[model samples]
Target chain A: MSNKVLPLLMMPEGKEGKVSRINADRGLLRRLIEMGFTENVSVKIIRSVKGSLIVGVNGCRYILSKDIAMKIMVTFW
Target chain B: MTNNSIRVALAGNPNVGKTTIFNALTGAKQHVGNWPGVTVEKKTGSKKYNGYEIQFVDLPGTYSLTAYSIDEVIARDYIVEEKPDVVVHIVDATNLERNLYLTTQLMELGARIVIALNMSDLAENRGDKIDTKKMEKFLEIPVVKTVATKGIGIDQLLDTVIKEAKKGPHHEHMIGYGDDIEEKINQMENILEGDITLSKKYPSRWLSVKLLEGDDEALKKIEGSPVLDQVKNILSTINKEEYEAVMADKRYEAIDVIVPQVASRHDEKMTASDMIDRVFTHKYFGIPIFFALMWAAFELTFTFSVPFMDILDSAFAWLAGALADNVKPDWFGSLLGDGIVGGVGFVLVFIPPIFILFLLLAILEDSGYLARAAFIMDRLMTKIGLHGRSFVPMLMGFGCNVPAIMATRTIEDKNDRLTTILVNPFMSCGARLPVYVLFAGAFFGRQAGTVIFSIYVLGIVAAILTAKLLRSTLLKGDPAPFIMELPPYRVPTAKAATIHMWQRGSMYLKKAGTVILLGAIMIWTLATFPWGVEYGSEDSYAGKLGKVLEPLVAPLGFDWRIAVALLFGFVAKEIVIGALGVLYGLGEDAEEANISDSVEADPKIFALNSLGLMVFTLLYMPCIATVGIIKKETGSWKWMLFAIAYGIILAWTAAFLIFQVGSGLGYD
Candidate 1:
């Protein structure tokens, strides 16, 4: 485990990280938060295809586009 | 307001089996409609529980009651406006922490809620010990463990609803935002109280919270208020976006503390669902597998419906023959035979295909593979500037465009939905297939299959380029964010899937029947008029109309008859071949084989002309029924006319290019 923060797109597949911050337009940001991407919550990259990834958070799997995955800042440990 | 009846609303995140429970409770007596002015579905039913008549409503499946999307706005508005006596919040016990987040928002809205702990069986199977007593005690809401798929605990749920309705709602579990935001919320609430009409309409505290979160609808409600300036002054100091984050964080934080106390879990382990997803959404094989499955669905839909369609075709043909033979007046017989029977028969022929297609889609949706399908195809769809949700509607355009346009409501972004709607007609709906088969089989002979396939590919290209053009020009913006929830897979139950299929499939019949039936009669009337002249002859009204447009189509090497048939294509694309048959003085409902020979025999029609006509048909405007749906869904006549105009212009340009290029190459 190490204290390194990077975009969720950069998180290696099959590893867990904590969501550090989500930078997006107001509507998308609220949606992201409602989907359980709040600060300090654990998120796992379950799979990646091309640039988009399947994120595992709060006992659910969400397929996020590359643009959205880039906006989410995750802290890997 | 009545003591003898209780109104209960069902609310939940998508894929919590909320619909399964809804179907279980409502049975076949459900009324399906759209929320006023929007396309989101609103369904209501009634059941008798404990000597009280209980009315139930199924709200759109959404994670929160925020105004970010239409579904969220509709759900929250229904709660705030209609004020159902009890809202049954269906929660997946396996993911109580996240599901409970919605529960907290429901608390804020100040509605009476009964928590149905759905899928509790799955949670127990995965080695989670859930203490329902503690959960009920903490949330102050009754908890009923329901396995919606198996129809378990439904009576208990209904019984709890009645009891809760009788006792009245308690919003006792209000979340405490930390001091700074709480003080601001209080200040806003005090200012909001100054507006009597507005405060009486919605909860002041809820309004304050929404205003502080930068909700557009909430901000609109405060317009022209005496305290508007004061509220704006308070809002001006803080970034509402940051406050939104903190408020949502507080809601989840409250759930976090309660979840730990109410449910303890063993370390998370890989489940069968994860294993299946690993294979289904795998990068290398995922796209190929999706195409394979989509091919299978299309094959099953078309092939299985053929026998039933043949039966309807023969049945209608016999009925028309009998009607003509038995009737006394000659003209009256034609009306019954050609107008009434033929008109209704056209609509019925599409029923089998529509029903079967909807059934397969519903089963896929219920099995949770639709989201995975969208996931694998997202990258390709993005290249065209459309959201992944747009793919379902685009693929459905092959079956028919009327229902396909209706399916665009799934897209949350206005620009994306409108763009998808505008381009859908070019996908070459099933109604247009007979036209392609007629043209290709007449001109290309042994290469007919290749030519027909090329026309379909051309349609795909047209749809792609049209969507790209619209995004870059009129509806310019990025595609909607492709954030989707992938629920754990379940073997869809037959009862639930059938109910789902019937609900969606039946709506298509109702919508298409009106325009097709009326348009059929109109085309029949046009061809039948000017009684002294030969029916549909050059001296007849139909021929006069064709003559009126012949010059417009002359550059494409088409005469009056071809122009008239093209004119009739707007009624429904399938009628184009039949219309041509009549223009050639054959049976109005002539068989495709007979029509193919006649079209080829006409000396004016050449291979190049036939090829160009096929391209024109492929790119033309949607059927009249689809045009109506476009207006209804987009809620404007301007967009509908835009869709019609752009389609014709593009069709003309493409056909002109093909004609000029093919001629210069000296193939024709």
Candidate 2:
């Protein structure tokens, strides 16, 4: 399945939680690794203001532009 | 004396949370300003701890110490000349190997070094362990783990810094290289050591390595000194071109050794970020995803802002009526109700839409996706001969043109900077948001969202076409190659993101009080007239001015009243709405009428007219402040005037065509 439609963060209350493993192709995998995304690292959904999800990776948070986030596949672990 | 305060400098790569850590340590004591004679920001702060006044200077973030850019030059100069009490080198723990490359360079600078292993929480969570003790032992500096965001390990980090500051420079520590390169470095260092001045400040071995790397800044620094000629003679003997290749090889060799010992990783399974990036960065899907997100942003801007805008409009109208009822004289009431309140109120109604627009933009920026958008759009940007780096500033233009033009500092090439600055005004700025919202809301109903979205797209297209034309003719040059480090994907902090949004939104509010206020008052005076006759009447002063210019804009179907609105728009575009409000004798309260209904009832206010106005706004001469900034940045009044004249001519021609063709299609 295409990873773009994956629901990566399951924020029932929209609080911080551990990030789930992603299922996608090799090219995406390599790019993510380069961007400091790896398995077992906790990701926090800080806020979903204006339909864009602001997630914190490691300790530093980056607002993920909405367009890029729609493609990452995941389910709340 | 122990009473003497020590100066410490914090340096790191961009997006490493260095600023957060700086704010955490210093709190309210910090002062922020630009570096001397340069636009790069400088931050300095001090805190008293354990009887020692620890002064901290936050140098601009840079990837390396090589003077390839202004920030790097500033960082290197501060360290080498000022000789800080201790240099705290902050590195991202998650990307230890890449971060340490800078660490090796810092050590070579011969300063008292302390490595802050920031973001330890993430490192621990990822199942990757960094043995701080081993790292300290191998690198020969104190290693302190810190999560700057949560204020973790900060005290310990400060304590280590204090201890290191007392010890002064670490002369014994040197990053080792292999025999071949080491032999070359030793020969050069020895040759330069005898020149007394060369050995006084800089480390000989570090100077030798930099000389070999063909760093021009370093070459210039050591130039004119007798020792430089000797170094040059040695370089010529060794073949200068090959010297750089050999030094690069040496850097890699050192990296090869330092990375494995100080860093270890657990091979993790595929993470969600990786999986998501795959399809998002895909050749076919990425562009479509970008369009979809932008579409959502447009939809939200129009749909969500309506209710708030309506409430604000009503509140202002009610206030205007109450003032009109209580005021004594007729002219006084007109000035209060029609002039001040009407003009300012017309512009004030757009606050809701501007706020919503900023919120959406902040969300996008805070999220790490904006960079990826730039990454995806790079090819298209290149095809039009504009650097992808131009995207960030242009994106910023959507917030405000002033800062967007200021952001041109990041674009290194002069020609690229000029082109980006010239075309930036075409991007639908926050000021123009109200004009579009007011017109589109009045004319299109629910379709207003799509209408606003199409206007933004139109602005972008005009900007691209203008950039291409300028490049081919006036600003001819090959666009600089696009190269940028894509930061890791993380959720942005609510505190930071909100602060960013408010800061941008507040600028608009401030402008309303200052420039827009003066503009509205002036427009009111022009529309007010000779003797007691309202200036808006066909026989008044404003009428004469508008009639004289009306023929010029007649092709776009604008009457004298519309011509007056366009005239005021040149002073500040927000006044376009206010000028229209006053001209129509719509007391401050009258502007609250449903715009969509008014446009529908009067077919003359066609979609074509709206489209033409949007195009004209996108292409017209920028607001007064932008013109001042253009003069300052370009340092020439000739170019500034050229920008103004060219913009107005282009705007008129484009608006004329859009209206003529669109009306031909029976859009009215």
Candidate 3:
């Protein structure tokens, strides 16, 4: 277990990361996991906007806002 | 084959070709209605295959059976209560990892499961191979390959469904939630085993798991139960969120093990969809690109349909004229010509532009770009106290407000749904597009498109402002967080797009025949009565009615005829044009004539007055059908009446300001 986890929103565009943890409300966390943000899943930042990020996780494209992205902690590859 | 019947439910995530499979199964035998209590759409179809009646229900697309949203609740409750004979879980083969998450929940519910490996061709095209046999062995469910769009393997899917329906419910597919949580669930199930009533109503094991997960809807259901206190006492001892997370993780762990064994994936390559998303959803380029595309859609909608509109206009005019000249009795001629032909013909003439607008919209929707439009617009929509999902409904309002209001059902947050519904009518629908074209054509002449476009922009601005006002006042809440999947763009098929276009367009034509036709005839009857005086003269019923309301609208520079048309527009916005045709004695052929000339002949309708009228039309009450749905959706007359009253005040104030300011600036 690496201690190098950071919020996914802070990861630079085009960088790949593995989801390590999620710090969000129960409902949002459940939604995020069902959307394939589960722990140990590989996620790549396809695009990052000012307050949102488009991430590719498990062959699906999701547009997640800053608040949602910040809650998803990941370790950069 | 015996005369046996099978009830099957289709469940899947959005964009997983569930609808296509439903269409493939049922073909033309499908019907859509609301779920028993909620407004979420319920689609059901029946087919006779092999001498058996197979009824299919398309459950709302949801990621999980958790009751986080209304759609999820409906899907969950239907499966739990209705107890469908078999639930065919449709999984997108290309995106198996995410789609299978829903499958885990369906399995937990103890449903008789048959997995339809939809879009297998797409997976193969992307250079991935899915071994259905290994997958079936792992999940203990029958797997059937299906390409629903092309109808390949559909018969095999149905045959599998029939076979699966005969097998009783199975609960062997449960994901192990480790030891501590599993212990608690067993304890809760043991306690529930004492209560005969609760066990009969629900799967006791599933209930205990959900109870440990702190599902609010599940907790609420056990309120009056004798075992509720014991259930709560047990639930209070466990940490809910941690257990829920562990449960979710275990499900994913199961999928993680199963996915690799069943399918081998090549390292994901950047595909064309990624390239398109790179530019289309680029932070700096997205907004401008979205607006540019919308502008092109509007331009195409208007310009492409002009010649067709002219053809319709002339054809209807000829019909009216031929009837009026050839009819035996003069009164019958007027009734047939002016009353029916003039009223209904005026409403029908605008069908071309409205139909084209819907066609273009259907293409955008089916091509999957509409979701991206919502994504891009989300940033701006949030400023006005809404999220991306609200934008879809507002965009649909451009077609017609009825379906748009219904579209708000997709917005999970109640306040968001209400605000979206309240502001939807402000998004200048195609019905109102003709009114703008008529006025802008009559007044602004050479710059008609620009004027019409400006009116549309103003509608958007009004909707935004109304949303802002609603958020700050009655429906007070911060904008809900926006999270949505952007499906890869697919080349929209002409057949699917045409079916969608005609499906929506037919609603407009239906409104023309029912609501609009009745309104037109009613207005014609009002204008033609007291049967002796010159038709449409001030002494006629409609004329007198307009004159009585004239003082109320005079401050906005509207004349009696304009006032009367606005009144009739309450029925349906298209009726505004039709009412104007009737009011000025221009007959059914008003659109074919230079309607601009007759409007210009009226001393009261100048450039400024027409501008005022357009602004007024943009903000005023939604049509009768829209108001009815608003009442029905909100389930409250208070909100419905409030919507109507506020729209009137808003319309008057906006129009008055424009007319007054324009006059002071010497524009008129």
Candidate 4:
């Protein structure tokens, strides 16, 4: 079934998402992928604070602001 | 390149304990300098193991070897161009999946790799088992378990490096890019081979793959190639972004296959680091906790450093007096007592504070609180249009601006880094602290701590306003995107903290010996000249020159002597105290007279003027060392000049307000 896909920032805390699309320029896109944000990688939103996110992807946690989080589109189950 | 001397390059992602491993292997035997034509620090150290002298080159930590950032370009360039005998890819064992991404790129670079499964103990402690043997077998590389902080597996790591060097350069288990991308890579490899020099310098397949993926640095490598026209045709036909995506996917696919077989976490419970982060980054308490910790850090740094500084001052005073008694000429006695010993002593006193500050910074950093601090503080930073990465460097600026400016290299954007550098000196470095400590102690008495704390607060306020002003004007642009890895917090060990502290703190010592020494002598010569004139009297060159500059600073309540002291302070802020000591006639009374007492005894000085002086010194041009580094890092005299001019203008205006307003309010 086709599930809802939303910006990573909009995902509920504790929900895991499959990173479907990354809306960033070339440099940032490459950085995203390098950090294991490639397509279909499972990204877990561990916490949301102050319009930023604490995300766990591939066993590593990263803190990112809403600006970057918004650029990342992820699929919810 | 020497017989029985192996050259090994250390590569890894940031926060992977790579530096700890390097420090363990090298152990104070390292030298840090910039990579040629780039400001990124290149650290090299040699260690003797197994009758082989192995030289280790510590590369900038990078997640990938792409040309998106200067760090990546520098790391990749060194690996491909230098062609080291062996490359030690230090993988954080607990985060193997995230780290092995770099491994795939290293493999593509065609370097003989030995994996240092670093922090294996941490992984095991977390209930994650990393099978080194299985990891090695699958990746076709030797994997050594290392807990670098404890000095574990260091010899094994060196042995593995030696063994790998002897076996020669070979990259096995290259990721297959599937049919479509592999065809493009093969096509470019054929084209690249025509340029023998290019093919010889870079792995043809790697270069070809990079070119197909639209790597900027890789594209520049084929600038004047014979196959340029044909390569352009092929690049035009391919979707570079898609190729980039697919190739990256393939690399991850390759890693996904191996990491699972080798390592798996047994427990799904929230990690201790996670629990700490939850508390540390909590909505209401996060910011207050951050401020409290910072307050504690500064409190501990200043409290512990003061007594050590006093003891050092007396020790130097005794040495200067002993040397003066033995020296030949009367002027020479003054030189030994006041010029050399006094100047170096003043500068050296700042070192305890610098060391203590960096020690605290290291504890914060190694515990991973710095990254969280950056995270928690990012919104406030971004409000001023400063990047999140700017927070670390600015915090470091409180220790010393020279290394703090150097720390701005992490800001991937050039303009943002430049902005960080320009506003950094306003952070009131350790060298500036001595000035405030002296003035505030003499003026505010029991309230001296509050006064000193206020100066720091004012400097931070100045920095924020300057950054806000900058982002709207000359550096006009959005701040770089804010995303940072928040590494797991670990209990900081004393040894690791000390190593981290000395890594940057020693810059203070070097300045004390070199730049500040020369400055001290220059100030001495200026004050001593015009024969028969009293040392630092009105008839001397320093006094005459200070008189010429007096009008400019008169509005801020500074006299000629204070003017001259500030002029010398431009060499390094620590010299402000030394210059004042000489001008106060403490030159002759080395052991008997105290500089702070001299200030307290002055007829023209009091609390308001002292506060004004502190404000002025806080915002003035960066020290000579910091100026040189700013120029080097920005690679622009234009920006350096702008920073110098902006600081002076800002200093004068701010101090003018403090002086005029404090007097207006009848504070004095």
> Best by TM-score, which number?
4
Clashes of each: 1, 19, 0, 0
Tens digits of per-residue lDDT for model 2, B591-613: 33532232234445666787788
Score candidate 4 by lDDT: 0.82
Model 4: clashing residue pairs? none
For residues A25-73, write the lDDT of model 3, one tens digit per residue: 7777778888888878888887776666778888888877667788889
Q: Write the per-residue lDDT of candidate 4 for residues B1-668, one digit (tens) a residue.
A: 46899999999999898888898998889899989886677899999887899899999999998887788899989999999999999998878777999999899899999899888887888788888889888888899999988899998888878877888767554699999887888888888888888788889988888888889888898888887888899999999988988888889899888877988854334678888888998878888997777667666666777788778766776666666566778889878776787667766765776788778878988888878877777778888887566878888888778778888877787778888888888888878877877777567756665566677778778888888888888888887776778888888888889977887778778877887788888888888898888887779999899999999999999999899989889988888877876666455454354444555688788888888899899998888888999888888999889889988998899889989998898887
TM-score of chain B of 1: 0.84
Model 4: CAPRI class: medium
Relative to the true structure, candidate 4 reaches a TM of 0.94
Question: What DockQ does every candidate get?
Answer: 0.69, 0.03, 0.68, 0.61
Candidate 3, residues B14-90, lDDT tens digits: the string is 98888778888987787878898766779999999997899999999998878678888889888877888899899
Over B1-668, each residue of candidate 1 has an lDDT whose tens digit, in order, gives 38688888999998898989998998988998878887666899988767888889999998888876788888988888888899999999888877888999888888999999999998898888899999999888889999999999999998888878887645444789999998998999888888898888788888888998888899987888898999999999999988887888788888889988999954435677888999998888888887667556655665666567667756765665566456768666665665556555544655776677668877887898877877877777788788666766876776678767877876778899998888888877766766665566567866665576577668867887888888888889888676888889999999998997787667546644665556556666776887866555677787789889988777776778788878878877766655554444324454432323446778888899788899888887877888999988898999999888988888888777777888789966
Q: For every candidate, what share of the true interface contacts is present?
A: 0.73, 0.00, 0.73, 0.60
In candidate 2, what fraction of native interface contacts survive? 0.00
State the C-alpha RMSD over the true interface residues for candidate 4, after superposing those residues. 2.0
Error of 3 at B238 (Å): 4.0
Best of the candidates, DockQ = 1
